[model samples]
Target chain A: MTTAPGSDRSDGLRLSGISKVLGGRTIVEKMELQVSPGELLCLLGPSGCGKTTTLRMIGGFLNPDAGRLTINGVDHTHSKPERRPTAMVFQNYALWPHMSVAKNIGFGLKVRKLSADKIRQKVDWALDLLGLQHHRETMPARISGGEQQRVALARALVLEPEVLLMDEPLSNLDAKLRVQVRETIREIQQRLGITTVFVTHDQEEALSIADRIAVMNNGRIEQLAAPAELYARPRTTFVAGFIGTMNTLDVGPAGGGVPLDDGALLPCDTFSGAAGDVCWIRPEDLQITEADHAGSVRAVVLRVIPRGHYREVLLQSHGSTLRAFTDGEPDVEQIVGLRATNALVYADDALVQDDEPARPGRAVRAVADSGDRG
Target chain B: MTATDTAPAAPAAPDKPVTPSSGARSPRRWSMLFMASPPVLLVLVFVGIPIVIGIAFTLGYTGGLNSIASMLSVSVYTANGWMPSLAAYGNVLSSERFRSDLGVTIWVTVLTVAIVLVLAWCIALYARLSGGRLGKMLSGIAIIPLFIPVVIGAYAIRQFYLNTGFLVSLGRQFGIQLPSWSYHTPGIVIGQVWVSLPFAVLLISSGLAAVPNALIDAARDAGASLGRSVWSVMVPMTTIPTVIVATFTAVGVMGSFTVPYMIGPTSPNMLGVTLQATFVAYLRPQDAQVIAVVLFVLAAGIGALYVWANARASRSSAVQL
Candidate 1:
């Protein structure tokens, strides 16, 4: 979706050095985040990673021990939740069980004390926008889960808040329904162009919907980048392992390059700072071939798992297990040779460098021929 | 393990059928039946039998359509029969004494219930807002009255109202004498409220707790003020429990005999005190029974109304959820 020119220039929200200490534990450390106008940022993390705490602080449900929150360049750090120009959709929907769908949608407008006719008009408009016009008179419990989710979304959207905060809004749905409902949410959010911060632990949900994903760990943002950037160029070992599958290899310096225990000399970029080493190669980066292929390390195939488009081979080599994905099936119990076009070296759980030469390596050669398939 | 092995052996012996006699009743079912029997029997005895007896008494010998027929006939009352007893009701209704007493009872009941409900809600809200140590302390303090006997509470209030009582003595030091409990309705109302406030607070507090914290956060995020959140969301969501509490409070106040009997003045009396006076002071069993029946009907009607209103509110509220 394309935005109108100059729309992205607005400073939607900025959280500066936010920190929270609850029950003698640092629930949210000094965190910083900036959301541009018309961008949907997902605060992706596992439970207890402080994503929800950060969202609550921004929404004014909580006061940070030390921080300033600025929205549209206006500091609203100590403002009450009611005074903040943000609406939240809770995980359980949190639709007022005592109000009709129209009333629930128009609750914010009513609290603002709009005239009855105006509230009626706005309520009708919101219900229509959510395709809930027919269920306007129905109670929240009378509606289906998906419809309730829409009511929650409509209730937040009707206020036309500058920022929308959602806390695992689709976690309550079944697998099939979660995908369906998230698509609806994404469409509505994009159409409205409201800057939103969605908190979720599901990696796929975050990657599929967020304009930018903030992978949080231990009350801190480990890495924040565009979805593709996060997946392809993860800055830290945590990000790489957390984002997708990888096969880690232990290596140490041998001859002029790092040598795996299996006696394979893998060239490395000297600037990578890899020492006393461990290196990680993504499974898909590994190419499996029949035995006797030159420049390839031989390993015995342990098992083959069919993964739809590709087969994942678990191989035992030099007392270590290495997983590699290949398009063609390799015979089990047969010695197979594996070669990785690219690998990331890590020392003590920190990514040190890519295992490709800065000047000349297999990755460079492949890029020259096929423009780098991965 | 043994049971599984025996199951296959039973099947192997096709001549022996799987019968209720062959398989002993599951111990689990036996325990469940044992657990269920006491309450069933208790309800049958305490609730069931009394209702049946009351209905029988209402329709049969004690008083039925016959009682109304007897009242209609003048032949039964030639300076005898039920004349003097029926005259007592007429005399009580017409007299200024009756007017004052009835007014006193109505005002006392109203004031007591109002004070109790308001105080209970405030305490409950305070408990809900305060967490950890302070919340626990406040909740513990709120129910302290429950552990104290009703007579003790009445006596405490009585002592507080006496001329030499703490507040009264302090007032006298400032040269302002406080009125005694005998002359004040507030004293009785306070005592009644104190006796009943804990129960109401407990009920309402549990109801408040039942309201999802998410809904409160949602309402606040949607621009609702604290007061608006309470009225629009919290109270409505807890309408059933609140009605239940209020009904209990009303019925309790209507049937209250101890607090008022101990502290109420001699000149103006509540229905409970009046009912006691008819039975004890006047030694009039029939008149007391009639008044007792009236009080029962009033309390029962209020209780029924509360249940009906609560059920209706719950039904409407359930649809919203």
Candidate 2:
């Protein structure tokens, strides 16, 4: 059999209009996404948001009802998982309980009928890469959860697959182990430069590990961009609320902008279809001050919680309650004022869809101004 | 912890150091004795006593070593009121008819167990993979044969093998002819297989269900071929139940009376039929009892072998776990 050329390093894995129907219910709608090569793309969504289903479709475990999946330039929608050069690490690890770590890692090579000596060499290399050589001969059950996860990664990587698909692989781990293992996974993916698609409901996991995060909601992609970019300039209200902490405000139209409930006119560049309302500001964007800063709005400090490195201040402004992440603890008993500048405004639960492409310079200016001022 | 500290310990303290009244001691001891007596008495009366009696019987008497010694001697039969019955052993071993009958019984048992297991595994696999209304219907269909009386099953199988029956009619329609059922060994095997297949399938299906789905998916994801997945994972995982089913089927086939009796001809008589003929037709209860005892020993040996193998296999799996 002629070996297929490596498509792993080529950027732009395009999923064009993919949909899936299962048990008479539409699981994944017409979804489209393009993940750059060497990019750790995470599909972040709540449970049953079709995140796992979309991953399975890409893995070829389930065939999409209608779609074209192309990695680099190769159309692989109909290919089997083994033939597609994709290796998946399941949430539960799904390591072969009957096989030793070495055997589990060497399984793909063995299936391909590699020489026994070559298989041993590759298996050893993979185990060493994962720092699991000491547990090479140990069965999966004999190892710790972290070690089992490492074994799973080693098994997937041994084949040198072009794409790595992870479905909540760290969720089974304890809280502490989850962070450690997730970091390890990110490091390994970066080092290998594999085109990885990670699926998780944990927003922190997606934001921390992924080069780009694709926020999914109701069987459709809400936004796809760099982790920080998506967080800072979320294209939809769902992405804004889902990715990070946000405080929504209800406002009515006033002076070509929106008037807050407290009768402050906030200048908004765009308006949602629903004319009378807009959601404003993220927690980190707001700052507590002795006096209102430039373009800062006044708010009452309701509750202040000291959270180790930062203090979370909940404030009420214009009949809407907002939370602010302050560097130091603010006066809780005294009536303190807070102001948020350069806040992103959302209409309903979605970002205002603009007809014109966003001006990058203006977006950067907005974010910089919002940085410390709240 | 708080609840425990708050509760009074006075009731529990009284039991720790008992200044026991004689009245309390007698009732407490008697109650304890009463509770323990039934199970102990049952064991002695049933298991312990029978085992002692069986050992005594095997040793050839209820009494002394002289009786055992005399029982072992050639002249013991002549000395005692019991007749010289060495002929019974000779008749069982030397007679070509008896040897043929034993061979037929063994052949039937082996063939029946083999066929039953194969068919059962197929049914079990179908039931597992296609678990829906259709699967339930197929499962119900498989059990239909079990509900049929063994005599009726035997008769139906014999009829199906006959020249004018369904098999012959179907064969005739397809321009083929079948052999008559009168003396067919294969027919006996088929009947036994049919009767035993449901139990095998039910046992094996339950075993197959216990195999973790994660294991199957792991094997598939690791690139094991479909056939290899079934053999390496499914079959190995369900081996214990399969062996159990096979053992039961084997023992059942070996001792089956109705199917072989109703369908098997006189010339190629099975051991059960032969034993029946000896006892009922020839008025030889003593000889029949000897054959019956031999059959019992053989079945018990097969069962023991299965139990031994099952234990070894289970121990290996447990060790792996």
Best by TM-score: 1
Q: Each model's fnat?
A: 0.98, 0.32
Q: Candidate 2 regions off by >4 Å?
A: A1-12, A252-276, A290-306, A316-319, A330-334, A353-374, B1-98, B130-136, B173-175, B212-214, B267-321
DockQ of every model listed? 0.63, 0.32
- Candidate 2 interface CA RMSD, Å: 2.6
User: Can you tell me the CAPRI class of model 2?
Assistant: acceptable
If you superpose only chain B onto the true chain B, what TM-score does each candidate give? 0.72, 0.74
Put down candidate 2 lDDT per residue, B177-290, tens digits, no spaces.
867764578778878878998888888889888777656655666667666667867887787788888789888888778988888877677889888887677655445545
| C-alpha lDDT of residue A37 in model 1 | 87
- Whole-model lDDT per candidate: 0.77, 0.75
lDDT, candidate 1, A1-374, per-residue tens? 12233334377988879999998999888899999988999998889989999999988999999977888777778889999989999999998877889989989999999999999999888888889999998988898998999999999999999999999999998899899889988999999899999999999999999999999998899999999988876677888888889776666433333355645453333424434366677787777776645545557899999999989999875566778888988888889765566566566666665455433445533332221111
| Model 1 chain A poorest 10 in a row by lDDT | A365-374
Q: TM-score of chain B, candidate 2?
A: 0.74
Please give the lDDT score at residue A240 for candidate 1.
82
